[model samples]
Target: MTGDQLLIFLAGIVGGALRVGVPFLFVSLGECLTEKAGRINLGLEGVLVLSAMVAFGGSYLSGSPWIGVLAAAVAGALLATLHGLLCSLPRVNDIATGIALMLLGMGLAFYLGKPLIQPQAAQLPAIPLGFWSDSAAVRAALQINALLPIGLLLAVAMWWAFASTRAGLLVRMAGDSAHATRALGYSVSGIRIAATAGGGLIAGLGGASLTLFYPGSWNEGISSGQGLIAVALVIFARWSPLRCVGAALLFGGAGAIGPALQSVGIGWGYHLFNIVPYVLTLLILVITCRPGVIVPGSPTELSSNK
Candidate 1:
């Protein structure tokens, strides 16, 4: 490619990463928090879709994207709280419950969001990061989501909370050992449920980004399994909030590969290129899930289920 073409291609990638990575960043951070609390919430796929519909619907009704964002977060927290409560019951498997919740969330979203698919909603505004450049492509690619900065700040805050806060210590303790937490006179279930709910609230914002930002519409296929993909992302990020940011951008950039090439007039295998993120997810799992390998910073209760 020539210099100008290369610049456009690279710019497309940067824009795609910023736009597409927002959802991944939010969902993965939510999952990271849940895991840190010694719980798993695979049902976030459902939370994501449901919140997207709710956000869009709220934006359409209120004519305010921020209200929609709040509505989405509430919806996600409600569903995630249910997941937490159900999993807390005696002998309930977290994985099984999560999968069921995923299906339920999707079904409910489809049914409730039928009208939403056709309506237009107020969209989240963007931060024009390309005014410094005269190129239209540069300008378009540099329109960063307003929520992107919030997600980044949340990552930094979460990292600090995990490293130097009392609440963070309790969460870490709960995830590492239930017996130990109990010995310390704390309720493991309570701690886990609270963490799961908080994570869900954060993840709801991810859904808001999907419908109220890039693509800026509501539809059944809005997610493209990005919520599920976030599980692998969290694992790849080794459960660190700070690391999740970079990992999210990498996956986001991977997603932008096909679009970037197409923008440069290379449309061949455009659909196939979209699978890059999935392929990357598979590679991460295969490499990390070896016979005797231990993932660094994995919560101990994840394996023990105690």
Candidate 2:
């Protein structure tokens, strides 16, 4: 690659990371919060899809992308709340409930989103931070979604809360030892339910990004399973919100490689690049799956920990 090409490629990667990482960032953070509360929500894929559809529909109807985002968050929180409530019942399994919710979310999205396939919706505004760049490609790449800053702040806030707040301590306590939480007369179910719902709300924003920002469309296949992949990402991050941000950017860069290469006129094996994130996911699981190798900082009550 020539100098200009290299610059363009790098620019593409930076842009792609911001765009692709938005969903990963939200989903991983959501999973992190849920896991910290001693619950797992594997059905986030469904949440992502359903939220994407709702966001698109909302934007289309209201002519405002922000409204769409709000709608998506509400939709996600409701589904996640249902998952939390179901799992709180006796003999109910979190994993099984999550899976069922995932299916339900997808089915509902497809059924209700049939009318959304061809319609256009208002897209989120982008911030042009690369005005100094002479290259159009670089400038284009630097046009980032407004939500990126919000997500970054959210990560910082979550990390701070986890590190230095009474609520965070309670959440951590519940996850590490329900006996201790119960001893304190706190309702473990209440904490977990709230965490799960909040997590779902965050993940729903990721879905809104899918429809109102990058790709900026609503379709049955909009999610591409980023929701499921985020679960593994949280594991890799070891439940740290800041680490989740880095991991998300890495996955986003990987997802961008194929498209970046193709933009430079290198089309061979483009599909291979598209699968980089998935391949990375499998490799992470394999390496981290060793018996007796407990991940430090993981919640004790997580089934995977047991």
RMSD to truth, every model: 1.0, 1.2
User: What are the runs in model 1 whose C-alpha is more than 4 Å off?
Assistant: none
Work out the TM-score per prediction: 0.98, 0.98
Backbone collision count in every prediction? 0, 0
Q: Write the per-residue lDDT of candidate 2 for residues 138-164, one digit (tens) a residue.
A: 898777888889899999999999999
Worst 10 residues of 2 by lDDT: 297-306
Give the lDDT of residue 179 in candidate 2: 85
Q: Write the per-residue lDDT of candidate 1 for residues 204-283, one digit (tens) a residue.
A: 99999999998899999999998898899999999999999999999999999899999888889999989999999999
**Per-residue error (Å), model 1, residue 301:** 0.4
